[model samples]
Target: MNELAFTSWTESTWVGFDTETTGVNPNEDLLVTASLVLLAEGVKGDLSQVETANWLADPGVEIPEVAAQVHGISTEQARAEGRPLGEVCGEVAERIVDLWRSGAILVGFNLAYDIRILEHSLEVCGLTSLEERAGGYGPMVDPLVWDRKLEPYRRGRRNLETLCGVYEVSLDDRFHQADVDALATLGVLAAMVALYPSVRTLGREELTDYTAAAHQAWAEQFNRYLASQGRDANVEEYWP
Candidate 1:
């Protein structure tokens, strides 16, 4: 176990996770593409040396035009080339557990969405839940979650592309590709830790706890904002 309480964030193994899915609703969306990668930053997101796995699934449903527009994966393409969701989800869970068991922290943008949706997919395929498979989610480093905590006053949309620019990382044309998104999220994470001295000093487990609490605070504040706007607040209020 990495018992060190003050390891440099850039000096540790990070497992980046991302997915291109059928929609935004975790309870309803299907994962179309997913990527998991093991990397340590060499000046940031330089993925020249990395171990990675990616999966494309048929999802057993039509891809919505809007989603396909964003991700560039048509239902025709997925049906023609994708694997069964059963094999895909099982393999993904196994890889994730394998990486996390060895002490690699999970890193991503807004990762809870992908994870919860993946758990739903596993249920659809009768596979074990990721929580059950891994026992629990490990130490995590979510740039999206942390960014909200660190810079709540930062203006504009919080999309990956926008935040990537805010962090001075070049995302280019890879906005929706799962592998690219995962790697870019890793870069964003590296940048955030480098910028936030307070976070840089934390152990992975400590930071995970901190992010979880920050996420809950953000959710509650957002729900209050939504209520004031006279809309139903239905965001997921817990971590995956």
Candidate 2:
């Protein structure tokens, strides 16, 4: 198969983003936690960067056990220490939009969910839409999508914890913290590029397009996978 020219994106700064929210539904749920790490200033031989900030928001609601279990932030802790929900979210959103405006690429594990959540927060805070402010921008890389496209036959869990093992990503701290998850996501992306040298062929913008399409293709591929496993194989959500 012919390869696409995708090189310009290679030199761009990649910002890692992650969030632990009150729940999954962007409309109803609140963004209780968020983090960002600049890949450009990462440590030697890895994409991990200095901890910029770990944001905790009050969410103005209870943090259910299920949500607390995932992120380790409790309602009591939040009430005592978390900044106002609007304030923390607003600052994160501003930094994100600023990063994009300055030409850095925002990379995340499941970027769509994180970005959508951030976008929702920005709208509520009366800030300009990130998409519009950045002129329809997207990430330099998205690890969850990248891994499925490049290593379709690989097995085992693809979640951050599993990838931490498969890719030798250090998860020294307990998992699910926003900063740790962002760092792990970057590690996964770095590992995928190393495993599949062909990915380097695409530049920044091309890489963005490739990842978006490849992720969708991977979803279709997984549906077939479900069929092979004799599962229901009847869902329609395919990583658009």
Candidate 3:
């Protein structure tokens, strides 16, 4: 495989990943659904060159009403239709590792959450973590980080749906489904590269370092603001 670099991102393979979980906490929550949407080289927005893999896990716990309302996956439905949690976690981890080994850049919106959840799930299942398997977590692109860095003053929600709107990317499907979110993330990234020459020009390692530093800077500023308001704040200073 050719060396992975951001300069040729449009002609490189990308794997957009997303997960829908039972709750908001990565440490306590369980993954209910996960998806990987692959956009091959020279095929941005071309469905014909895309491939996808999706999974639903039984989770081994009740899918809370709030989470079910968000993702439309009831516990009863999951128990009946989903695969075992260990099986799902192992498959998802291995598939992601395989893609990384094949030189695909991972793309997501707020990917750190998903990556942490996956890491927790693998530990729970007694399986190897993604980092152990892949030797590292990235080459990755997080549209959330880039959007915040590029347009810091544009203040509204930066969630996936809002980003799709901001970037003029279509989100034709429902919001919380893992597959739909993954595809929407890819669309947003494609739009970002087209609009921001800086994003298009960075090399792979350079972009990784840039985003990591950017996230740390944002975390520090946010923490200071929270401290001024007398609120407890400890936003993570790492990137995915």
Expressed as tens digits, the lDDT of each residue in 180-212 for candidate 2 is 788777776666655666876765567577777
Clashing pairs in 2: 6-202, 6-203, 7-203, 9-203, 9-204
Please tell me which predicted candidate would have the highest lDDT against the true structure: 3
Candidate with better TM-score, 2 vs 3: 3
| Candidate 3 residue pairs in clash (backbone atoms < 3 Å) | none
Compute each candidate's TM-score over C-alphas: 0.91, 0.82, 0.93
Higher-TM-score candidate of 1 and 2: 1
C-alpha RMSD of each candidate structure in angstroms:
3.3, 4.3, 3.3
The TM-score measured for candidate 1 stands at 0.91
Candidates 1 and 2, the one with greater lDDT = 1
- Candidate 1, residues 72-150, lDDT tens digits: the string is 9999999999999888888888988887787677887888888888999999888889988878777777788888989
lDDT of 2: 0.72
| Clashes (N, CA, C under 3 Å) per candidate | 0, 5, 0
**What does the lDDT read for residue 89 in candidate 2?**
76
Q: Which stretches of candidate 2 lie over 4 Å from their true place?
A: 1-8, 41-51, 124-127, 223-240
